[model samples]
Target chain A: MLNEFFENAPCGYFSFFDDGKIFVFNETFCKLLGYDKEALKDRNVESIFTLSTRIFYQTHFFPLVKMQGHAEEIFLSLLTNKGQHLPVLLNAKREEHGGKLFTSCAFITVPNRKKFEDELVAAKNVAEKALQENSELLKAKADLQQHTERLDAQIQLVNKQNSELKQLNHVVTHSLKEPLRKILIYSERINDKAQPNILKLARATKQMRVVVTGLQQYVWLDNTPSHFTHIDLNDLAEKAAAQLRQELNADLLNLHMVKLPSLEADAEQIQLLLYHILSNAIKFKKDEKAEVTITATALKQNIFRSVEHKYKYEDFIKLEITDKGIGFDPAFKEYIFDLFRKLHDTEGHGLGLALSKKVATNHFGLIEADSRINEYTRITVLLPLFQTTR
Target chain B: MQKNILVRNNVKVFGNGTQPMLFAHGFGCDQNMWRYITPAFEEDYRIVLFDYVGAGKSDRTSYNAERYSSLHGYAQDVLDVCEALELQDTIFVGHSVSSMVGLLAAVEKPEYFSNLIMVGPSPCYINDADYIGGFERKDIEELLETMERNYIGWANFLAPNIMGNADRPELGQELTESFCSTDPVIASQFAKATFFSDNRKDLFKLKVPSLILQCSEDIIAPVEVGNYLQENLSNSTFKLMKAKGHCPHMSEPEETIMYIKEYLG
Candidate 1:
């Protein structure tokens, strides 16, 4: 029974007689490494196993089996037919039978048993990376949605405004028809008794026509974008002066000019922009004379200011309009360039300074306002010179 | 520059060739409100349709509360239209709130208009001594609250519309933009100014020939009040149309147009 038990163990087992020689090996041990039991039988241990493992077996496995009588569950590496290493655990013991010393070993592969643990770690890493990517993608999608919504809203608002503007134009234009017809009819209907009022009505209708033209011009000028064209500076100044001649009593302006230059720019916008600035100067003119001077200089050199986003400019034209107006405090620096920003309750849209800045920016230049409270205001405008390259 | 008796933005004789009729629409509508009624009278009368400032297609920039607060402002608007058009010796028609506006305009310049026709008239909104204006300040306040709540509701309602693609509209976004465009505060204030206004006292002193077409079973203008007006008005006719609801022009257009044609004839 004892011999049968020793020979028929579940795993490969073996015993040695204190010598580096195989005393016994099972069918299972040989099969585990893709070798036949008979082929490995009685083979020198060093030849069948690798040298390092063979040395370890001789030194550790032999001593432990010989001295301790048993060495159970030890890890070891074994070589296969293809020269690949195999992880394994060995069990062995020192034994004495019939007055003979012997060493025995038993083993099974271990790397296969570690598969569950490694799979757990890999799954954890994958989940963490997927979670990070999902959140980032979600955030990016949300930001894109918000941007699209805002743009769509702006577009819709613009369309609605355009529609209303068209309707307004229709109403205003259609309105002129009846009044114009009445002027023609009533002028013919007047006799001596009703002649005075009738003639007055006719005159009013003609005046109405003038008012309509003014309305159309105001709307047109307000809507047009700042497009560049050949502009006459002196003409624009004089035109503005003429436009406000009736209201000049409010400002009591004495417009004077130094030698000025005319060039290509957004003609209507520049006209309007200058008009706004000059008007603001007059509207807030100090106790001094409401006199304005216009001058120009060739700004060919580069300007190095301590500001970010330096302009890639090759040349420029500098124009300065100085007015002895009730200038604002210097503390309001750059505020004049803000749209609808008014420091005083003066007449006209608060677009004067803002419009000037817009024109300056559109010209690939900048505008600076230098002034002292209750003193004088100087508006400097820089214009980019056009260039061509081969 | 020949300023007459300052008849509230009035232009006396605006148009020629047998002075045509002029129409003034109520809030939220332009002269296009005249569309349902004008064609009935267009064969015989040259009709004029114009929007008021801050409403419909009128100049929104010109909207100032102090200038456009009362029927007086609306009356001024009528006068301005007449002056702008050079209209004269024509019948004048007004709807809803503009009904009182037309009456006041006629009073301002009697020579400019042959008659005044007021549709779906309401003289006052709140009840006072021997008078029923049909609405109170609290009612208008509640209306404001309702509008505020409704605006929020509408925003949520339209969320889907804006969120979904342009082709596949989400119902949510559609409602939100529609409600968002109409400022709740403005609509409430406008409603209070509209529903709570009182212009009944001006009726007893009417000088021009006038026609009042009141809708029967109207929540805005009750039938009993219409009868009471017929008894009290000095030179006016109160004819109740066979229609229900505040706006017969929307629910029963043909009946409303027939009544208008009858009065016009």
Candidate 2:
């Protein structure tokens, strides 16, 4: 009965000598490897394992067992003659026989446990990937937000500088101009017919006054806090046209108005912007009759490439004032908005378009001009619909 | 910084002599493996014993996966111990995998060491077409699986049995408790790093005098491996012992000590 119990154990059992020559093995152990007991004689225990497992046995398993005297719950795959793999958990203990050390190993196959472990490894990999993505997204958002805040501080600094420049312009206007006024009045009072050069000097002084007034307007852009209220662009366009009627020939200057959207913006600044653009259209007209078209629409896409960094918002109110004028080269488009930049003969001081750009920037908007030489010039002003704290 | 390495490797200095002798233990057990051997040399040589990080009583917190992934990392630890103590012309007695570790340390900085004693060393554990390393790749995987499954209960099962001397039961129990004290994860990593590493090409670079103590019968480091080491090493003496297992230092310390003394002469 004891012999039967030894042969018919639930798990496979084997005892190998120090040299790895198998001395004894149970019938169940032989069955597990699909080999008979007599056929397994003098066989190295490493022969039953796969190539990797055999290496494991020599380097890790054998060394640990030799030094520790026992190794428990080791997983190994037993390879059969037919190339079938049986995954098994082995618990081994070193036993002494006649003053020599031998190892007794018990093998128990666990197929479902292997599957469960694989699932656990897979779930861990997925969780790690998700955590990595979440951190990356958070980092990107924080970077963008940090950049935006820096830009806000820079805008405030530029506004402060503009106010300081306006203060200087006010001083120049009050202190120096009073002396020039006396020179103009005294020269006009002389009215000497023989001295024609005296009259020319008087005319030059008057021109200087006009230039100084234009400089004052340019400097005062950031002086007043913007009063944001709902105002119709169509009304501003009509008012601009009426103001420029003195310079424009009504019959030849054909003004077309498209249905314009109302926006929350500085009414005074919007009126000034419209006036500057309309006056420019009349000033640089090529044909006998100037046809100026003013149109306004809600910007659905982000087309402002240059100004994209300034604002994180995408929605804007775009107002385009297209003109039948002698336009400059398209390559010179970027320089047109620069201060004192004159593409054509100067009728007004070159500050008109520069001041227009300043107005758009101060309102958290952008103005760009696209043109073809001797063709049409389209000036686009993009303004956010909602008010922004300047 | 030297103190950190001392704490990290759990370096212990013993004996009273001018000549320094350093002993590095193998994978599973700690510095206690050299207890029997170091005592014999204590009167003549200054003995130094240390546990590799993550093994024995070394600091587990300092085990960096990248740093300790290869044999080079353990070699650095050996060098650190030498540097901390400011020892020169030291005799290094490395057992099992540590033999190769000492070889690597000597290779990096040879001026510190005077002689090398390698006991049961294998340069590479995996067999190739031309070379027989006595192991295939799959055996290593099975061993890893065994380590994982046995990791939790390893202390309870093997510690007592491993301290196998029957004469002193308390010594066995103490060794068992100390063996069981290692962190499971670190032990597994140390096992992987030691076993999977290959340093066959580095053997030719050694310029120091060396001794290869080949045991009579060792399944782990077979006779063929010993023969290969004897053939490859440049400045070395090969001695075959009648001792039977991989660890003669523990099993037969007197014989191990006698051979070490002869080699020193």
For each candidate, what TM-score against the reference? 0.35, 0.52
Docking class for model 1 is: incorrect
Expressed as tens digits, the lDDT of each residue in A79-196 for candidate 2 is: 8867787878888877878887788998888888878755764575478569957986896698789879988998999889777886788776887688778988898898694687
On TM-score, the candidate that comes out on top is 2
Best by DockQ: 2
Q: How accurate is candidate 2 locally (lDDT)?
A: 0.77
Q: Candidate 1 lDDT, tens digit per residue, A293-390? A: 77765433233333221222244566778888778887886886776677887544456676677666656668988887766888888875552210
lDDT of 1 by residue, B1-265 (tens): 2242122222223233365777776543344444456556666667676666554434454554544555665676677677766778868877777777787677555557888877777777566777765655665564443343333333332232343223223323323233212233344445555666776766754577888889865555677667766776777877888765445664456887787677767
Model 2: runs farther than 4 Å from truth?
A: A49-51, A58-69, A79-85, A97-101, A121-390, B15-18, B27-29, B35-44, B125-174, B178-201, B214-228, B240-262
Error of 2 at A103 (Å): 3.4
Cα RMSD to native, each candidate? Answer: 38.0, 24.6
Best by the lDDT measure: 2
TM-score (second chain) of model 2: 0.92
